[model samples]
Target: MALRFQNIKKKFGDLTVIRDISLDVGDDDFLVLLGPSGCGKSTLLRMIAGLEEVTSGEIHLNGRQVEHLPPSDRNMAFVFQSYALYPHMTVRRNITFPLIMREHKWWFHIPLVGYLAKRRIETKPDIRELVSITAETLGLTQVLDKHPRTLSGGQRQRVALGRAMVRQPAAFLMDEPLSNLDAKLRTAMRAEITRLHHRLGGTFVYVTHDQVEAMTMGTKIALLRGGDIQQFGTPREIYERPANTYVARFIGTPPMNLIEAQFQGDSLRIGDRLLPLPETAPRGDDRKVWLGIRPDAISLTTADAADALPVRVTLVEHAGAESLLAFDPGSLRVARDEDGQSDIMATQSGYSGIVAGDRVGLTLDIAQASYFDIDSGLRID
Candidate 1:
């Protein structure tokens, strides 16, 4: 049940939304299409499900080309963000709908006859047992007789999943399916879906703009920008060794700090402070580079600590298990923040006694730092 996209492209009139993209999703792999809005993650997912047409190139399922197939012929079940269950039908009816449609006949198209045929199909021994197993699997048996409107958001989402499960498709294509729930519910559902994937052991291609979801759930992530993939790798690979500045800034909480620096003979210069470079750092004299340091890699210490850079704390935020401190490294310019301000950030576990307006010493774990070419923004490995 692997999926392969070779030089795939999609366009709406003159505007191209998916460029010449090529990637492979292994059998039973949970591949997440991750990016910000308008990055074509959803469009790519739709292309896999045949809901949207590929403008060029090819899409293959298990080595068979399927880009030309219609939605029903693809054998992929789609779970949508809206939890698209029928309001007039009970949970059992909704879950059984796909099964009924698959065995439909010409006489089933008639108004009165269609209703009767569907009812008969729903009560068949095999259909009832299948629906019952799906309901119990999703913890939906208690709500089987209820309509969609009477169910909670989580329950309705389960019903949508149950509907998809009844088909036993080759792959599950989800498009932001958990986005409609509240924060707590979304967190619960994230775990639920992970467990479901493990139980079913089926291929899953999910699209989402949330980095947390991408990091926590995906076995592999394809990070896209505009219409092109910026980076594709496992969560640890992408986090520890980003391909470029865009990925460095997009993957972390508070993101990685990119500071403009000079690479001297044997040291890197940040503002007036000179620090020895890591053993693996690229050697260059008088070259400009972007120095990337994760927030967790910087430690706050007393002003007299060895190799510490003096900074003035500007803001301190207490976030449950950790404290985020934003500071000003005098005469040093930090890369532009998301809100257009320049500030160096650090994190300390548990509660922090340090407050704003305090001058402190910050020490960076030089070995953990990343270097990038200033002009190209690509990692300088």
Candidate 2:
């Protein structure tokens, strides 16, 4: 049940959104399409589900082309963010709608006698058995008679999932399915979806703008930006070795601290200060490059250490279980500085001893750092 996208592109007349997107999703992969809003992640997912027409490309499922197929014929279930359940129908009716439509003809919806026909369709032994089993699997057995209006957001989401599950599709396509829920419910549903994927062994393509969801739930991630893929790899690879400065700044919470420095020989010159490069860092002739270091990789010490850049603490934020220490490197100037020319921000996590106005030395784990070319915005090594 592998899904392959070859040179896929989507355009709305003069505006092109997805351009030359090609990706191979394995049979049991939980591939997440991740990016900021309006990145064409949802459009890409819809194209695969046959809900959006492909401008030009090939989509293959199980080695068979499906780009020309209709949504119902694709054999891929789509779970929408809005749930899209019938407001007037009970949980049971909503979950069983797909099955009934697949099994019955138009005559089944006759005006006043529709109930009799629907009952016959619903009572069919195989359909009833499948619906019952799916309801049980989704923990909706007790709320089968409840309407969507009366159900909790989580419960309604489960019903939507149940509807998709009953289809027994080869793959599941989700478009920001948990975005409407609160923080606690979203966390719970993330684990729930992951468990369902494991239990069913079906390929899943999920789209979301949240990095937390992508990093925590996806087996692999396709990071998109401006209708282009910035990087595609496991969470660890994308986090530790980003493809460029865009990816380096996007995937992390506080984001990888990017400092503009002059790369001269084996030392990175920050204005008047020099920090020694690690042995593994590739030597490049480019004079200007972006130095990327994770917040947790930076160590704050009261005493000066080797390869350390001294900075002055400007802010201290106490987040339960850990603290974030913000520092400003004095006299450092880089051409691409975002805040101001005099600001060189460094974040050190799990550090609480330092307060505002304290001068601390920053020891970067050079081995874990990344370097990106300033002009190209691409990783140098």
Candidate 3:
């Protein structure tokens, strides 16, 4: 199912949850709304599901506007962070509740009487068969007769998913559905959900604050913050070519290092020294700029390299196969070398972000590193 969120806005009294948000999920696309807590990801998902009303704008599903449609009529299913299973109902009953509702319009899907109507109509067997198949696929077959209370967290989760799948809706909306699981189970569930997405071949709009989930599972990622989208792109595009400083910092581990500098004709000045920037970046004098470098893009050593700046070592953190070294390049300046230049030399206030006591060489990968206009937060590519 294709889904479009067109200028969707949501607010509660004075608080805006989503503002002028627009996004599209092609049929069968797996889209992740990735962000930190209180970023309005859940709010967006709810608006799509009709669990929450949009303060403004509209939502479309499969070319049809569904902003006013109740969740039931939207041809979608929502799996919540809470397993949301009925404790008194057995797995079979829970999974078939929707089917039973369809059969008995007046019964409201009473676990006991809904099946009675299904039996009278001879559709009970068919419902059982379908539910059983879904349960088996989700690894909930063995717990078919157990109450949700008796199942483990993972088992209960599968049951919740089973309930959603049995409806076979055109799309699935999940809001951090795996957040309650432990680390190991969460990793395993991430793989399982990724596979399920392929198996169903249906639009899946997932919301999560977990970057690990976003990076490993999303085919398309919409990174959001403070009720607005920071960037929306494929995982590779987001990680390699972030649209701005916020997206760059949010998408990476340990985050990108932000070194302040200025543009001095033909050289990039950090604090006091002049160095070269990639010919690709803008050039000017005393232009407020920031040097952005991913941790992996940086390396340290005692050997001499053309652009390597030597500095005092601060701390070394070794994580299994790789190690990280902290260094400060010393002083700062935004001046072009005596040689006529087009860009400002980079200044290295040094990486002593906090305790500045020693001078260490800081090497900038002008190639991999990005320059941003500090005042505007726009990339200087």
- Residue-by-residue lDDT tens digits, candidate 2, 91-200: 87788787776666454553523374358545687877887898888788999888899999999999999999988998899999999999999999999999888888
Top candidate when judged by TM-score against the true structure? 1
Ranking by TM-score: 1, 2, 3
The 10-residue segment of model 2 with minimum total lDDT is 333-342
* Alpha-carbon local distance difference test for all models: 0.90, 0.84, 0.77
Indicate which candidate wins on lDDT: 1
Reference-based lDDT, residue 302, model 3:
40
For candidate 3, lDDT tens digit of each residue in 67-147? Answer: 998887898899999999878778887888777666565766455564563363355567778987998889888888888
Candidate 1 per-residue lDDT, tens place, 1-381, comes to: 388999999999999999999998898889999999999999999999998989999999988899999988888999999987778778888898888777763344535444853576556989888889999999999998898999999999999999999999989999999999999999999998898899897789999999999999999999999999999999999999999999999999989999898989899888777999878878789998999999999998987677788889999999989999999867786788668967998999998999899999989898999888898999988
Q: How close is candidate 2 to the true structure, as a TM-score?
A: 0.91
Q: Which sections of candidate 1 miss by over 4 Å?
A: 105-123
The TM-scores of all predictions, comma-separated, are: 0.95, 0.91, 0.85
lDDT of 3 at 229: 95
